[model samples]
Target chain A: MKNRLRVLRAEREWSQQDLADRLGVSRQSVNAIETGKYDPSLPLAFKFADVFEMPIEEIFLRD
Target chain B: MTTGHAKRRYHLRMAVAMAIYIASLFVADWLIEDRGVTGIAAVMLASVPGLCVAAIFWILARLVIEESDEFLRLLYIRQIIIATGIALTGASVWGFLELYMLVPHIDAYWWPVIWCLGTGVGGIYNKLTMGTSGNCT
Candidate 1:
């Protein structure tokens, strides 16, 4: 599962720590999400979409 | 920012618990050196520190409980299962070695057993599985 988290975060000038802080999770988690190492849960995925102000489809996609 | 039980507080408690466990272990050996298990004080000495360390994990368990996210819970559960499984397997292997090749019974020494098991769980297993398909929170 790939995600545009890194791209979105970069657009917002947010580091992995910044995104993790906003989402109340560890930076490792954010890194995992960004690198496609871990897939986010539905709720967390939605939250990420909400945080990025983009639709979930736009942020996340199957590879 | 660390969540749940504040990393600093968790580390402090863990350190205190470990310190108490080691100190109590020495005390238990000293007090029981002559009297052996018959001395009730030895039991108390050993038990106090064991409970302290158990309490530390208990607190950590509570922190784990506080997380509503299933992803986080699964991470913890996976770790615990690995830890417990490794511990049991190592203990069984030690028993086998003792019974078959060396002594007739397993030695009472626990620290070395725990250290080896801990190394397996913390180092080997962790390296093998980088957190079981963790879903990001």
Candidate 2:
């Protein structure tokens, strides 16, 4: 899955650790997800949506 | 359920189980070999270390279950799968070699020790492939 997580995080001026803290995950996890090395589960995707205050589709995109 | 809490619990439980495992191994050896224990008494004495090893496995399982982070959990799952594969393959090959008299016989207990080492190998694998070595650090 492709995501604009990096752009979204950057837009918010949040570091990976900042996003990770908001999402209750490790910075490594944020890095993995941002780099497309790992995909988030539905619950975690929901968490991303919640944290970014955007729909999951807006944060993540079909690739 | 947080990473820090889960890791702390895992480390504490693992430390206690390992301490018990070592102590039980020595005690069991002393009783069975030095004291010349026999029959059911010897069997019971010899099982303590094995039971402690089982406890260590239980502690690891609990860490997997209690971990809330999906990525960390995935890393642990990967580590366990790699460890299991290495341990089983090593034991099976060694068993065949022993059966064919191409190698010396080893105590079956060594398989679990190999499995423990394989977990370290798995962590290294994770570090190379996943950019993180899970929570064991």
Candidate 3:
């Protein structure tokens, strides 16, 4: 999966740790998701989308 | 979840557990060496509850990591299984050698065997029953 988390966070001037804190996950996990090292589960992706106030499809798309 | 927080808590518990184990070992040694203690008295006076503390450390470490993720747990399981296989094989070989070739030496070998089994075997038991991968941390 490809996600715009980095872009979204960048736009908001938030660090990975900031997003991780909000999402209740490790910074490494956020890094993994951003770098495509790991894929987030659907529920977690939804949480991310909800946190960003964007549609899930807008934030994540298939590579 | 805070990995840092969880890691700190787990490590603290582990350190304390190790301290208790070491203290028990020291006390056992003191009793055996300085006071010439042996046999069932030594077992009752020291070894039994040392075994129990070691057992409790394994149990409590699991509780400390109860909120950890799947990847970490999987890593721990693999480490433990490998360690146990090594320890058990070593113990069996040593036991066989003593039973066939030596006298009284096998009795002396008990602590090494127990220590290996307690550390690896206990961790294995802890990681297996805890199902560590499904939690929030």
Candidate 4:
């Protein structure tokens, strides 16, 4: 999976740690997802969606 | 963060467990030297290391339970599975070598040592493949 998480976070002036704090996860997880090293679960994807206030499809894409 | 507390506690527990393990080793050595591995003394000495191993298991279980992040928990589970596979493979290879008279006999305690090393290998595996080490400590 590919995601615009890094771009979105950058646009929002949020660091990886900031997003991880908001999502109640470790900063490493945010970094992994952003770097495309690990894909988030559905629930976590939804949480990202909720955090970004964007549709899941907008943030994540099929690779 | 939520995980910060849990991570700190985990580290603290691991430190204490390691300290106890080292201390017990000294005690076991002293007992063995003084008592010549008599029945009760031998049992007591053996139990120290046994308890240390059990403590390690308890710590791993506690990590799984205390971790609130599902993704991190999943990573831990994957690492443990890999560690177990490595340990089992090592044991099987060593067993066959011993049976064939290709190697000297090994104590059972070495299995746990190998398993612990496997956990380190698992961490490296995760870092290579997952872009994160997924370290519990």
Candidate 5:
């Protein structure tokens, strides 16, 4: 899975820690997701969508 | 939730349990020496160390319960599964070796020690495969 999480976070001017705080996850989790080292579960995807205020499909792309 | 409070509680509880476990070892040794490992007193003395070991497990269970982060919880569960697999496999291999008279006898209590070491292996496995340590602390 590939995601535009870094881009989205950058647009919001949120650091990894900031995004992690919003997502209630560790900064390492955010980094892993952003770096394509990990993929979020469906629920976590929804959480990302909710945090970014965008459709999940818009943020995540199948790779 | 991986809060500071939870981490502190885990450390405190583990420290206490380990202290009790070490103390129970001494007590068990003293009892066996003095009482010759017979009677209800010996059995009860032996159970004290086992109960302290169980308390360590209880601490891990409590950590799992108190962690609210779903991803971290999943990681913890995975680590525990790996630890259990390693411990069981080691025990089975050792049992077979002992049965064939190829190895010396080992106490059953060592299984938990193997499991604890397996958790360290699991942590390394997570770091290698997951690209993160998955350390809740």
Candidate 6:
């Protein structure tokens, strides 16, 4: 999956650690998801949507 | 609990298990070799270290279950798979060599040690390839 996580985080002036904290995940998980090394599960994707205050489609896209 | 807390507990449990394992080895050897313990009593004595080793692995298993981060959990499962592969392959190859009388016989207990060392190798691999050791630290 491709995601606008970096852009969104940048726009919000949030570091990866900040996003990770919001998502209750490790910073490494945020990095892996941002770098496209990993895809988030459905529940975690929902968490991302909740954290980003945007729809999952807005944050993540089909590759 | 948090992964950090879980890891701390894991370390503590592992330390206790290792101490017991070492002490059991010494006590078992003393009873069997010096005190001439035999039969069921000696067998029971020798099983203590193995049980401790099993408990150590059980603690690791609990860590995996306790880890909340999906990525970290995935990494841990991958590491375990890699470690299991290495340990089993090493043992199988060594078994063949022993069958052919090309290598000295080794105690069966060494396989768990190999598995433990393989986890270290897996950690190194995870660090190199995934940018994190996946150790939950």
Worst 10 residues of 4 chain B by lDDT: B1-10
Question: Which candidate number maximizes lDDT?
Answer: 6
Q: Write the per-residue lDDT of candidate 3 for residues B1-137, one digit (tens) a residue.
A: 45556666666775676677777777877898899998898877676545645564475457446634433444454545555566677677777877888634655435544654544554555445443222211
Predicted candidate 2 versus true structure: per-residue lDDT over A1-63, tens digit per residue: 999998998888999999999999989999999998899999999999999888999999999
Per residue, candidate 3 scores C-alpha lDDT tens digits across A12-35 of 999988998787776656776787
| Superposed Cα deviation of residue A53, candidate 5 (Å) | 1.7
In the order shown, the chain A TM-scores of the predictions are 0.92, 0.97, 0.94, 0.97, 0.97, 0.98
Tens-digit lDDT string for candidate 2 (B1-137): 69889999999998888898889889888888898989999898888889888786787788889998889989988888888999999999999999999999999998988888888998999989889888452
- Give lDDT tens digits, candidate 4, residues A1-63: 999998999899999989999999989889888888778989999999999999999999999
Per-prediction DockQ? 0.32, 0.82, 0.20, 0.72, 0.47, 0.70
Question: Across all candidates, what is each one's fraction of true contacts kept?
Answer: 0.11, 0.67, 0.22, 0.83, 0.28, 0.50
After superposing candidate 5 on the true structure, give the runs of residues whose Cα lies further than 4 Å from its correct spot. B1-3, B35-38
| Index of the highest-DockQ prediction | 2
Tell me the tens digit of each residue's lDDT in model 1 across B51-112: 87566556556546655544455565565566666767777887888878765665445634
Return the candidate ranking by TM-score, descending: 2, 6, 4, 5, 1, 3
RMSD of 1: 4.5
Model 6 stretches with alpha carbons more than 4 Å out: none
Could you tell which candidate, 4 or 5, scores higher by DockQ?
A: 4
Writing each residue's lDDT as its tens digit, candidate 1 over A1-63 gives 877787788788999889987877776677766777568889988888778888999999978
lDDT of 1 at A38: 67
Q: Could you give candidate 5's per-residue lDDT for residues B1-137 as a string of tens digits?
A: 45456657888998888898899889899879875887888889888888997887788788788866655666666777788899999999999999999999999999998888888788888788777655532
Superposed model 4: Cα runs more than 4 Å off: none
Segments of candidate 3 deviating more than 4 angstroms: B45-65, B68-137
- Could you give the candidate ranking by DockQ, starting with the highest? 2, 4, 6, 5, 1, 3
> Per-chain TM-score of chain B, candidate 4?
0.90
